[model samples]
Target: MCVVHLLDNPDSWAPASLQGLNLCGECNDQMIADLRLVAARWDDAQEALHAGAGGGGSERHAQRIEAPVPINVSVSDALLVARDNIWSVVLRLVDDHAVQLPVYQDTGSLAEWLSRSQAVKIAGSADKTFTKNAYWWIRDAAGWTVTATHGAETKVDLPDQFCKRPGCNAQLVVVENRAGAHIVQCSADAGHTVQWDTWTNMLKSLGAQKRRGPRLSKKRA
Candidate 1:
């Protein structure tokens, strides 16, 4: 479920405790850890919010400075949305999935609790969507936190890949989150996104097919 993870990588290929939760063990652990990090960075994001430097010498000349203006607003908004979604998912995990954990009042507390407890029940939840969505929620939060705290990371454009969305041929970009997770997404606002492993595996499969050559049809009687 993690963006940095390779679908074919055997290192993360452990079976889930429940068949309903399709995520592997590494992804489960990583998801919880990422959630904790999202909470941890909230303060950092707040500190950097609208703290972008303007034309001034007091800017403490650094190699990279926080992004200014619209970028700040966008990152902040994204982080807020991600946080809300994550909390909602956690609540469902506790109430619906029968997790016996106490929901803390503060974001940091609840996040830390999840990190410590590892919320195995979440990984074993009968709700198949929770695992996948929880990971994405934290993933988006982590990326925004990194952007708000530090300037936006360098987004490498995928030259060969273009957005599959019709009328939107924007090049795809590979975004790396604070937790080392990555996603291949459309550079434009089409919201056409693909997981890294999914894209890589597709390329690999196509390459193998090309290498094998096209199958010939047998002569009919």
Candidate 2:
């Protein structure tokens, strides 16, 4: 992870979040890339600081500073949050930390927000899809079976080595199906069931995929 010195005052910051935008039709890959570049630069700066430097001047002192994580500031807090129907990012500058700012971008439509939220949820599901909490089903010679769900579910079959959850461990097998939903029996019993939000989020994500796959939106202004 990159590191940077945080200014003592939280008020100082550049535009950190995207702002003044409607439902974006696509994603902003360039924006993402730019963010990554910025992160890399910060990482370089931190590395340079870690390497002992001869006593320079105020600039060196400033470079030596490190920023605290989960930084609280009025600067815009950029995010890649998904709403569902429309995907967008924001660069809004927070005026005050006390004010409860909107976590997601304001698209001026609740329906739009709901859709975007659903899409975002689904996108998140696609990340660790093999995990038990994710919506994972298998349709072999038997029939359509759910491998994992909210409660204790099981799968039946011996595929030697297969993923129990849709996207958790890649090395697991369907032990047995107690009910309609298939149960996931993994070699690594990582104590942690699929989170409720993750399950529902997967549904929303799948729904979004049915509509639009990955997209990109850029700042024209």
Query: Judged by lDDT, which candidate is best?
Result: 1
Error of 2 at 158 (Å): 1.7
lDDT of each: 0.55, 0.25
Candidate 2 TM-score over all chains jointly: 0.19
**Residues 179-199, model 2: lDDT tens digits:** 443323344542212322223
* Each prediction's number of clashing residue pairs: 0, 43
The lDDT of model 2 is 0.25
Tens-place lDDT per residue, model 1, 1-221, is 43224333434533443344556667776777777786686556655545553433121211224544433544554445545655776688767756666644444455666677745656665554665556665555555555545645445777666686878988788766555555566778513555455566556544545555543222111
